[model samples]
Structure formats: C-alpha cells, structure tokens
Target: MSVTTRVYVARLAGTAVFDPIGDQVGRVRDVVVLVRAKGAPRAVGLVVEVPGRRRVFLPLTRVTSIDQGQVISTGLVNMRRFEQRAMETLVLGELLDRTVRFVDGSGEAVVEDVSMARQRTGDWLVDQLFVRRRPQRVTTLSLRRRGATLTVPVEAVTGLAATTRTQGAARLLEAYEDLRPADLADVLHELGESRRLEVATALDNERLADVLEELPTDDQVEILSGLDRDRAADVLEAMQPDDAADLLHELSDEQTAQLLELMEPEEARDVRRLLEYEDYTAGGLMTTEPVILGPETTIATALAQIRRQDLPPALASMVFVCRPPLETPTGRFLGVAHFQRLLREPPHASVGSILDSDTEPLTPDATLGRVTRLLAAYNLLALPVLDAEKRLLGAVSVDDVLDHILPEDWRESHDERLDEEASRG
Candidate 1:
C-alpha cells in the first residue's frame, strides 16, 4: 500500500523566492505546495520578488525535487539573477532582486521589493511586495514597509493551490473569479499578450465590457482576436457603446461584418453607425450608451434610477439630464443637467432648474486638439456628442480620446533614442 505525507506553508503563505542551488537569486512572494494521497509532497509553483525586475515564474521542469518542506530547483532555467535582503536563506537570498508580480493583468510588474512579517499563525511570512517607480534613476525597487499590499481577500483567490504545485505559465482566469473591471484591466495590462488573451477568454460578457473600457485600444484588439465571432460579438454588445466602437475600428471589414452578424440587431446597428465615422475624430470616439432622462424628471426619480444601476456616489456628481423627446431634431438629444446641481437642490426639483447652462457640447467634426481643449473648458469626462441638427448622438470620455490618438510607439521611440545617445557618447 502507498503512504502519504503532509505539506504546509514553510513560514507563512507568502515567502521570498530564491534559487535552491545558487548562493543568492531572489525572494519568494508566493509558493504553491502540492500533495496527493498517492505521491510525494512537492513545491509546484513559485513567484519570486526581486528588487526592480519583472516577476517571472520558474517553469516546473526546472524543479529537481521537493524536500525539507521547501521547493528545490537548481536555478532559473533561463538566466540567473541575484538580490540582497536581510534574514533570508540561500534559497531566499537568490531571489532577492528578481522581480515579482501578483494578480494584475498582462505581464509581471517589475518587482520592487518583498516583505516578511509575523502572521497570526505565530510564524514569519510574506506580507506584501510591490512594483515601484523612483523619482529619478528610471524604474527601480521600492522595498519599503509600505509597499506590496493587495486589497483582494484570500477567499477571492481561485486557483492558487494548483498554480503552486504546477509550474510553467499560469492562467490567472482559472484562479480568480469576478474581479472588478479596473482591477482586471490592471492585471491584463501587466500580463504578457498570450496570457492576457488566456484570461480574457475566461471573462463573461459584462465583465469583459467593464475591463474592456480600461484597456488601451490595442489591448482590446488583442483580447478580441482570441475569441470566436459569436463570443466576440457578445463582448462588444455588452460594452459601453463608445468602447465597442473603438474596438470595432480596429478589426478588418470582413472580421467586423462576421462579428456583427452575431450581435443583437440593435447593438449591431449602433456599432455599425459609429463605425461609419472617422475613427480618430470625436464622432468616432463618442459613447452612445450614456444614462439619459427627461428634463421633467425629479431628483428623487433620478436618484432611484441611480440606485438601481448601483453607480457609485462619485459618479452621481452629475447624472446627464436628457430630453428624451421624440419630435423633429430628436428633442430627446438636446437636454442636459449636472448631478452636482441636482444634489444641491431639493429632491423634488426639475432637472431643467438645476441644469448647468455652462455645459458646452461637441460635434462630430471636432479634432483631438479641439477635444482636449474642450475637456479643459468643461472639466468633464462625459461630454455630449451632437449631430448637425443639435441632436445628441452619444457621449465621449477624456480617456477614450487619449487612448485612441496616443500610440504606444512613443515608448519604443524613447528606448531607441536612449540607445542612440549611448552609442554617440
């Protein structure tokens, strides 16, 4: 008959990663230990936090064995890195300066620092680590006590156990459930392109919509490329109209039509109409999915609607007061109100009474130059989009405009310029 053994966290659930064979490599921020009734206990996965470096996993193949209640690996299968830390092991010290990332999107945030502290279990364990930026010296480590903390609860972690036992690339989708859209976006941005797609494949349409708004346009395309036409259509349909239009602009006409066929008739038409506009122009960037109500509506009614949508208080600062009229010139499009003015007045007040006459609207022909200038004028995130007849077609965000026109090419250009200066000197 076969026998089994028990395995638990070495000190705390979080420990600094290190090279088992090297004098110093890095620190372990996360570790997964595996055990089965039929086999030996072993360390399955690892994330080492080194000061100011990208966090990379040690593929499971590099592991030699598991003993002494710890993971044993010869060295990183790729190249070797070393970092310095106080009160760590050869295994621990090896990982000192290597980078590590927790649950953020895309690739590893370069590791800035690792921290250890006493847990309620009466043992020392990893507390929090972080990726940091320096005031000078480009990107560097931030290992101070204040960095490296995450708000996510332990209950929220999905596949941490299996991830630890197994090595190679981790699919975070399998490990986490229902992350906030912003949080999910941050994770996707940090993951590599391939892994980003892997996680995107796991999200539901609404969640996809939420995170889709937060990603840059290129990343939205990357995530869309991973889905089939039907799934892709569902994702687009669920998104805020402006965000969906941005992604559609990136797809080829053939791919666009194919995905459109899978969308609901209403959404497909809305997206199609937006696609007809020049992508870089304001008309192309405006969102058609904004909340609108009649000018006659009461604050109490608007407040009820806000509660139903579960919008945060900050967003309530100005709910758009829409006309909702169906007459010629689409009278519904001409109405407007600010949330701040509403809250300051009595609950029974009419939207028109509190409407900020100062609000300035934008037309489709506007350029990015004009858009930025107008945003500065209104100090607004949600701005109105109107047709020639002054009929409101949609709303545009300051973020959408910037994400569209500003190419990531700048980062590469800067890198090249640095190399050139180095060569010239």
Candidate 2:
C-alpha cells in the first residue's frame, strides 16, 4: 500500500523525530498544513518539540519515512522558531474538535478527530474528517442516544477554515453556543491538558467566564493558573462575583491576592466582599449581576434591558428597583418587579408603582436553611441579600440553594456521564 493509505495523523502526532544517523531530534508536536482553494490542504511541515529548547519547524520534504512510531528526518531541520503563517493550519491544535457546517445545509457536526495520508508526489493530505453528529434527544429518560460518527471529505464542510483558522477563538466558541455552561464545562474537562489549553486559549474572556463558573473548583483553579496574568484578570472580572470568589477561595492566599490585585478595582471589591462571608451563607451563594433598575424606570425599559443583556434565566425572572450602581452592589434596594408583573402592566407604567416588596429580603448572614425556607414559603425564584443598611448586595438564585440541598455526590454523577461518552467513543 502507498504511504497515503497506510497511517493517520492522530497516530503520528506523538511519534519520535530522529535525524539521518538515528540521533533523536525531538517529538512531533503538531502537523502544519497549507490550506488551498480545492482538495485537501498540503501538509507543509512538522512542529518538533525539543527539550529545553523552543519548538522548531521541520519541513515535510526533509522527512525520509514515518515507520514504526518513528519519524526519520534528512538532517535538514529548520532551527528558526515555528511561527504559524497565514495559510498554515496546525492539525492537532486547530482542526481537532472544531465544528463545521455541511456545504449541503444538512446540519453541523464537530470534528472529533481526523485522518491524513502521504501522496505519491511526496505531499501529505488531510484525507478525511471524523465528525460526530449531535445526538438526538428522546422525551423519555429510559432510552439514551449516542452521537453518530461520520466520515466525510474536508471539501464538503464550511465554517472551519480561513477566518475560522486565523481567528481560532471565534471558531472554538461557535459550535458550543447551543450548549449549557455545565455541558460545555464537561466537554472541556474531559480533554487532555494540552488540548484543554488549546481550546481555552481560543475562547474570549466572557465565554470562558461562563464555562469556568460551571467547572469544579479544582479544574477552575488549574485553568485560571495556567493563563497569563492579564488574561486571567480579564476572565476573573467577567465572572459573577460569587463564582469568582468561590474559585479564588480555593487558591492559596498569595495566589488569590495576586489575582485580586490584577482585577478591576470595582470587581475586585465585589469579590472581596463575597469572600468575607462564610461559604454556607446566603451572601456566598448570591450573584452580583442582578437586574436592578431605578424606581422611575418604565416597565418597557426594564423589559428591554432584560432582553438586550440576555441575563440568566434566574436573574431575568425579576428586576430589582435600586438607587445607583446598576451593575454591582448598590444603594437602597426599593423593591423588585417580576417579569410576570411587567407583562400585566402597561409599557408606560413606572416599575415603582407595581413593585413586589412584600417578600422580606434575606440578610447576608442568613443560613442556607433559612434561605431555603424563605424561597419555598414564598415560592420565589430569587431573593435579594442585603446589608445592615439595606443596601442590595446581591441576589441568591434558587439554583444555588438547590446545590446545597442536593446530595454531595451530584458532581460524581455528572462525571460518570462524561465517562460513558468516552466509552462510546
């Protein structure tokens, strides 16, 4: 059989790279491909990782043979640093796990993996894409569906090249928009360290913030610690104050302090306040991003803000009327305007005239049991947490309260689901 039909890129990724005389050069870190208008992209070179040295580019033409888990080279390696060019694509880094739309408009799928082969003309081609279709959901819980894998030529897909290749962050997030944060976090957690970092590097601060919020504390710490200081600060700033505080509390005091110093002063202050509360208290479980509005704000305006911001379902259930500092903890919290109430009233009606101030707000130090009773008795989705002076600190959602009441092994059950996915793969 010709080399083109013999081996796959996945199998060659970690193979040893050796020189002509059998001297160890390095190991294959990534495969570089030059994308073109038609046909599979031409594999241009290999990114070789040498211990205690920068990654270097090894041109494919200099490769003698790939046999028995070893890549024999012609002793003509490029010592210059391997910076990816405009047309070059890193198969392992960029192509794997990417989502592409079918050119025929049938549907979209994720590239679970890929296959490549060397041509008779001494060129390597990306021969096939191993795609996994989104599983169909059944109305019943008894029957589970598994994702089906499809083998397709790269030419039949769109949304995974050009702009997607150059701006990897956008492409990485495009396929995952439909997923809930918890599901997305599960996917990221199952990936190996290198691949996890590759995907993380491609997500913007806000999107990464949502995913990190759903991850376990240990995984959150690991991912945050791995990022550069500036990016880490930006991501932390984007997270809800309670989530950010919980993650920071898992780190050593020194690490926490360092990150806090890098964060925006206002956001840092909010996190600091949340950190002061006991982990089991209402303040600790509250999110600072509540839908607060002024007393005189019109019902239509409040509704518009909720729609424009795309607030979480819990927070969007109601709007709190407050004095100032709309985005963070602020002045006197007057009352709340429920979504259902907004719909009943005229658009020009002021929220203050129809506020629901009947439910007593919870104090910062309120116990989880107290919070649960207050929510259950009043049938409320969220309850505001206030300070001694009645300032709106944040709001504890029903979901956070449920997290405490649920069994401790709830997370383990979630991980088992991912394990089943791996088994199926």
Candidate 3:
C-alpha cells in the first residue's frame, strides 16, 4: 500500500493497526508528538490499545502505510506499555479543542483537528490545523452566531505549545462527552498531574463537581486546591452537601474555612451541618438535597420534580413526604413515597394518601451498620434521615452506604488490578 502524504491525526483514532502479514495488532488511541520551541511538532508514535487493554507505543518508523480505516506496520512491535515523556503531547487529548489566536489579527478560533505531513526526509511533522472561529456577538442585533471553519497553516495561529498555560479542554471534553462521571474520573486519574489540572481548570464548575465526587479523596483535594479560591468554592456549592463535606474533611482546617467563607451562605450552611457529624454516621452520608414534597402536593408535581435531568438516580428513586417547608429541615416528616408507587397511582392523587409511613426513618446519629441493614431490609434506594423532632433533614442513598463499607483504598486497588492484568498479558 502506498503511504498517504498527509493525514488528520484525529481521524486515526480507533483505526485498526495490522502487521505486515495482516495480523491485527491493536487500535489507535492517540498520536504522540514532540512539540518544538519555534515550529511544528514532529510525530513521535501511535498509542495503541492492544489486547488486555494495554496501551503500547508504535513508532512511526515501524509503520508501512496509513490508509483509510487502517494502519500497516512492520511485524516487529514492542509489547511494553506506553508511558508519555515530559516533552511529549497527545494530539487528541491535549491539543484539539484548544482556543488559539490567529497571527494575522483575525480574531480567536478553536482547534478542531490537526494534520501531519510526511516530509522528504521521511519524518512526519504536524503542519496544518483545522479550526473554527469563535462565535461572535453582533452588537447591533444583540445576537450571537457561530463562525466559519477553515483549514489554516499551523504557523498562522498561536497557543499550540505544550507549555501554553491557557489551553482549554473544549475539544477534549467533546471526545469524552459520552463517558459517565466515574469513567471520566478514571481517565482524569490516569493523566499526569499537570494535564489533569489543566483539564479540570477548563471544565465548568458543575461538570467538575460531578467528576470530583467520583474521584478518590486525594485526587479531589488536589484538583480542588489547584483551582482559584472562588472557583473552588463554586465547585463545592455545585456538589451534593454530603460529598462536599466529605471532601472538606480531607483538607486542613484553614483551607476548608477559607473555601467555606467564599461559598454562598445558604450552600455553605448545608455543608457545615454535614461536617458536624461523624464520618461513618447517617448524617455524614446523607445528601441535604432530596425530593421533599408537601402532603398536598399532587403526584403529578412530585413526578415532575424527580424527573429533572439534574437529579441523580438514587436520589430520584423516592420522594420524602413532609409538612410545610419542603426544603431540608422540613416540617413534620410525614412518610415516604416510592417512585414505582407514584407511577401506579392517579396523577391527581395526593402523595400523602399513598405514603409508606410504616418504614422507620434513620436518626442522624444512627450507625453505619444500622443504615446498611435498613437499606437492605427495605430494598430501598434511599433512606430518610431525621432530627429529634422527626423533621426531615436529608436522605442517605444506597451509594453512600457502599462508599463507606468499601475498603479505603478501593480506587487505588482498582488501578492496580488493571496494571496487574496488563502485566499478565
């Protein structure tokens, strides 16, 4: 097969890799490139995920052809895992979706893709970028419209260097948009600390908060510490009160106080309340935000509230029926209504009529063991936590119970297992 003169690196993602005799080797995951100080970066190798999910480097020199949907390589291929060097950059992971300014004063644009060309010397060098202009506001009409996309020489734009501090993760996030928060956290955990911080910095507070909840405590603290104080506080406010409190417990008193002071008073108050409880108690595990409804609320209203896209599945599993004041610390906790039961009843029926008042609620000081047993015995997704006056305070989801009962180093152990499996292969 004749080698193509130029190819867009992003298009190579998931392209099959085969040996000279046509045996499949792996699939392309990313392109490794050595960034230069004053010019285009030189292509280093392909990061290929082979059998056993092990990522190994395939040097461009070993590649015989780069055709549509496939790459042909020399039979000799190293099986060792790929480890990125300090001077290396991942084209798909780090470069794409970055905002850059054009050298000719044509306004800012976002990097959509990059193209590398084989030179006369047989070296592959990144020489062009496919970019879309940033959306501009039309002051006259008070409207905004997306700009056109154009292919420009790499030298025509700036901020492509690996050292660029202002790099954004727009393109990178698009590539991983389908990933769940937990899976995205795993990807973030595998990145170098600096790159991970960069990506975190680029994410909006809400998105970062969701990802932080899924990360290990140390990682959560590290990423939070890297953000600006105000931004960090905003992220905390975006997280569930229980999760925010758990992360704050891992930080120093001074640091936690400073962040709390930066947060909105209403949001900080909920977290402060959770922080007052012991780590393994129901209070510490319960989220201050749950579907709390008044007795008079129609089943239609309750269903509409839980059907919100923002509500987590566990929290949405049931509705806590209470008296006046539907917020936490709600008046006279009435009972609970399972989601399935709501679906079976008429939409106009009141939640108060179909309550499961028999099931007992957990007090804040209830032991973790008791909470776990109740969740199992009732087969409940969430259990309400109440105060001495029987006022609804929060609800402990089954996920919170599992997080506490699991080994402290479970996340680390999961990573180790992946490495062990790769080593065996």
Best by TM-score: 3
Model 2 spans with C-alpha error above 4 angstroms? 1-178, 324-329, 407-425
Instruction: List runs of model 1 lying over 4 Å from the truth.
Output: 1-171, 189-195, 307-317, 326-334, 405-425
Model 3 weakest 10-residue run by lDDT: 416-425
TM values, all candidates: 0.57, 0.60, 0.75
Local accuracy by lDDT, each model: 0.54, 0.76, 0.86
| Per-residue lDDT of model 2, residues 1-425, tens digit only | 21324456665665788888999999776678877787777777887865533356888777888888898888876555455675777776667666687898777677766677777777778778878765444445524654678888888897666434322333334534555567567556644555566677777798889989877666788899889988998999999888899889898999889999999999899899889999889988998888889999999999997785647777888998988766556889888999999999999999999999887899989999999999899988999988888889899999888766776546435333333323100
- What is residue 326's positional error in candidate 2, in angstroms? 5.0
TM-score of candidate 2 versus the correct structure, residues matched by position: 0.60
Top model by lDDT, which number? 3
Ordering by TM-score: 3, 2, 1
C-alpha root-mean-square deviation, each candidate: 15.9, 18.3, 5.7
lDDT of 3 by residue, 99-174 (tens): 8889998788888899999998889999999998875555644335567999999899887884456666777776
Question: With candidate 3 superimposed using the best TM-score fit, by how many Å does residue 168's alpha carbon deviate from the native?
Answer: 3.3
Better-scoring candidate (lDDT), 2 or 3: 3
Which ranges in model 3 have alpha carbons more than 4 Å from their true place? Answer: 1-6, 11-29, 33-88, 97-112, 116-162, 415-425
